[model samples]
Target: MRRSERSMRPRRAGPVGRGDRGYVTAEAAVVIPTLVALAGLLVWGLMAAAAQIRCVDAARAGARAAARSESGADVVRVTRAAAPEGAEVRVTRGGGLVRVRVTVARPRFPVTLTAEAAALDEATVGGGGR
Candidate 1:
């Protein structure tokens, strides 16, 4: 065999160290679960934010209904309709003002969202001057 022929042949790679044999597999085993959990958390966070917005809208709707002197049942119905699932509504009236609060809780996740709003009673809108 010519020296040039031996040099031209492709060299085989050296054997991997025992420690490095399953390193990539171990990393993937750990990293995949971590990544999936992170993605789940992100999705849950987005859902919580959306629920918070719904709470705010529900509160506002209830307040408007109360301000217009709608029946208590009607105000509650409106608020609940606008709120996220498993929501609670509270209405308070005083000093010619109506206040509404909405609270929401998710069954799968341990979190609570709430919002409150107030509006002047329509009947109290005007009354001034001698």
Candidate 2:
């Protein structure tokens, strides 16, 4: 056999197909960033969800306060205080209902959260122990 041909021959039982050698490293190199990005997205989504829930809770609190005839300014302040940082709260009364709307800015990301709640009037619901 010529030297070139012999050298080109596949060696028997060599390291050619030994359990996908170098595959793990290559796959890790390709998939690690994607996984990291997914993790980041998951964290951001969780944060956004939490912000929304908090906004809803704040709205509920404000609506309840406003329904009690509390000062509108105080209700708004309370709502803003209850919400997460960088949040804007708006309270309005119309048609015997107190509506609270909140908008929150996400940290380290470009996102805004909005939530609204209406206060349940005691008069409308059999009165508040009046």
RMSD of each: 6.1, 4.8
> Candidate 1 lDDT, tens digit per residue, 1-130?
9999999999977776865898899999999999999999999899888889989999999999998889999999999999988898999988988999998755634776889999998877776222
**Candidate 2 worst ten-residue window by lDDT:** 121-130
| Position 91, candidate 1: lDDT | 95
Off by over 4 Å in 1: 1-19, 106-108, 128-130
Instruction: Please give the CA lDDT of all the candidate structures.
Output: 0.89, 0.83
Global lDDT of model 2: 0.83
Model 2: per-residue lDDT, tens digit, 20-64?
889989999989999999999999889778878988999888888
Error of 2 at 22 (Å): 3.3
* Pairs of colliding residues, candidate 1: none
Q: What is the lDDT of residue 30 in candidate 1?
A: 100
Each candidate structure's TM-score, on Cα atoms with residue i matched to residue i, is 0.80, 0.74
Off by over 4 Å in 2: 1-13, 16-21, 105-109, 120-130
